[model samples]
Target: MLSSSGRGPSLVRSAILLAIAALVATFFTAPAAQAADGQISGLAGKCVDVAGASNANGTPVQLYDCNGSGAQRWSNPGDGTLRALGKCLDVSGNSTADGALVHLWDCTGAANQRWLVSGANDIVNPQANKCLDVQNRSSANGARLQIWTCTGQSNQKWNAPASGGGGNPQPGGFVVSEAQFNQMFPGRNSFYSYSGLTAALSAYPAFANTGSDTVKRQEAAAFLANVSHETGGLVHVVEQNTANYPHYCDTSQSYGCPAGQAAYYGRGPIQLSWNFNYKAAGDALGINLLNNPWLVQNDAAVAWKTGLWYWNTQNGPGTMTPHNAMVNQAGFGQTIRSINGSLECDGRNPAQVQSRINNYQRFTQILGTTPGGNLYC
Candidate 1:
């Protein structure tokens, strides 16, 4: 090599070639995939918005209805920071609490600025083991942003725009974040032990991919609204009445109650009761629920699936599935009619239907969709 570093023509040429190779390597080995610029939807169907559309450091990050404005746009540059308005989402003074404010600061690659965008739709700050939450789960405009324990509330659900965000006008996939479910039913942990609820719903393509974006949200909201009423916000995994525990069994059925006469009591999200319902739900879910009614209470995915099955299928006392009732514009009333119309519809019990209607209305508002007319059966 003509004495390494001595200024020979061959040595100079080789050095230039090595430098070019290094440059080429650097060019080819680019950073990780860049997160697409879009809005991140959080509590109350609001987007993680930039206050006043300001790009300056220390700008407040709050929840606002997604309006496609540049202020609401965000990016994850594969560098552990969620960037918006060219600023990193930073935790104020690196605090970890139920209400530590989140704001924009210059990108510093700090641990407090890093986040783990989980499959459950939670923007978790691993440094604190907390989530990016809309303070107090408020749905109103100008709600403050904070870092709180990952409670799986709707306020902590950060749906990226590309995934059919929580409030964007564009069509998005149907997804129920654990956080949203937690917000709707704060008492779930006491009864439900199942995890991966979002993943469970994702397995059923029809659940999230149904109808347009509005319809999808309506469907999900309606389902959850009715379910909230059915299970008291999923606080009760099974019916509470001990007397009715044995009443669900129908001894006349061909298969009978394999899970015992008392085993077929109300269980799962929709309170799937009776021997026939257990058998049918079991057949649909590929599990022997007729012989194992306890599965619904013991398995979270099975429990939610049972509820969804009933929502998508059985009309109960109504004329169509609850899913069809919402998508076909039959209104929320039809869903009540489909579920328990015999008891609650046709002026039999206005209060019950009204309760369901109230839930639907409130849930729809939270989801940012209008609950259509005929809210009563």
Candidate 2:
């Protein structure tokens, strides 16, 4: 999965790459054949499409049997992002690694989202310093795209959209799309859903939907990155280590751990745990979570709302809410402090702190915002 991104390997690789002749023998499958406007015909003469023609962000940009549908109609807009159906063709996770998936996502001006037309129309992601490659050189329909070491092979060649002009700005209202959510947490439990998250947004209108457009996008990325780290990309629906489950109960609270000593174990995007946390969050959201902490695990809306509750209100170990930390330009580091500063910040746990930072940077790139400074707590 190593990339040719660095200067040394890139220079050498470039000098060695030779453009191979285009495919022939099968007229219908030859990408060299004339392509109609607004379509990027490639290997097998298949048009690059948003898988299932879905406008959902993070949809795969794949070589499918060309049918001239709207999914195949692309616009270069000259912005470096290849857009179709209102989303950019992006390298998954903003990844530069070889074999990294190329998918449709919110059009962020991030390095990985930009593409360059190389010799013979090879679309390249300068961030990865690799060519857009059809995985395995298969000419079959539904073949996916990837970033690979540029070999100048036909698989790396694309009848890409013309690079120039401006495409539509990302659709407003919500920064993170359902497909982008899936991309961020490909293995996330089904318990967390985009609809569930959006459903909970009205609960905290200013959390991600506030300020300037950049601020809005940045805040959304910051919140998701923090939660992604806390939940391991939403893969864990609840605390994994059962040994620590019972420790979340605090009998000292007046509520007395109504769901049981272990029922309050970590759950939801931010690992909302503890009897007190459940009780407080429930009261704030007007739901009875103390007796049914499991609702955070069983109901998607409840699960996401709990995470939003913490992000919008609870400061935990720090002085400000995670929401305030982001919108106030206090830097992503502050959110870390607010969430788990006692355990993970200020070199208390460098690796874990870094995991949160890495997610922040990657997600900000995906959301089309810069990760402002003071990333370390």
Against the true structure, what is each candidate's TM-score?
0.53, 0.54
Against the unseen true structure, what C-alpha lDDT does each candidate score? Answer: 0.64, 0.68
Q: Which ranges in model 1 have alpha carbons more than 4 Å from their true place?
A: 1-173, 193-196
Output the lDDT of residue 371, model 2.
Answer: 88
User: Each model's RMSD to truth, in Å?
Assistant: 24.2, 19.9
Q: Write the per-residue lDDT of candidate 1 for residues 1-377, one digit (tens) a residue.
A: 10112111111101111000000000000112222357777665678888898888778889888797888887655555677778988889877554789998998877678665554566666454456778767888888899765444577766663322222121233444556656666666555543635545522334433345676677777888887777776677777777767666668779987778888777767777777777776775567898888888888877877776666545565566676676666788887877776666788878878888888877777777778777888
lDDT top scorer: 2
Deviation in Å, model 1, residue 40 alpha carbon = 33
Candidate 2 segments whose C-alpha is farther than 4 A from its true place: 1-172
Q: Which ten residues in a row have the lowest lDDT in candidate 2?
A: 1-10
Model 2, TM vs. native: 0.54
**Residue-level error in angstroms, candidate 2, position 156:** 55
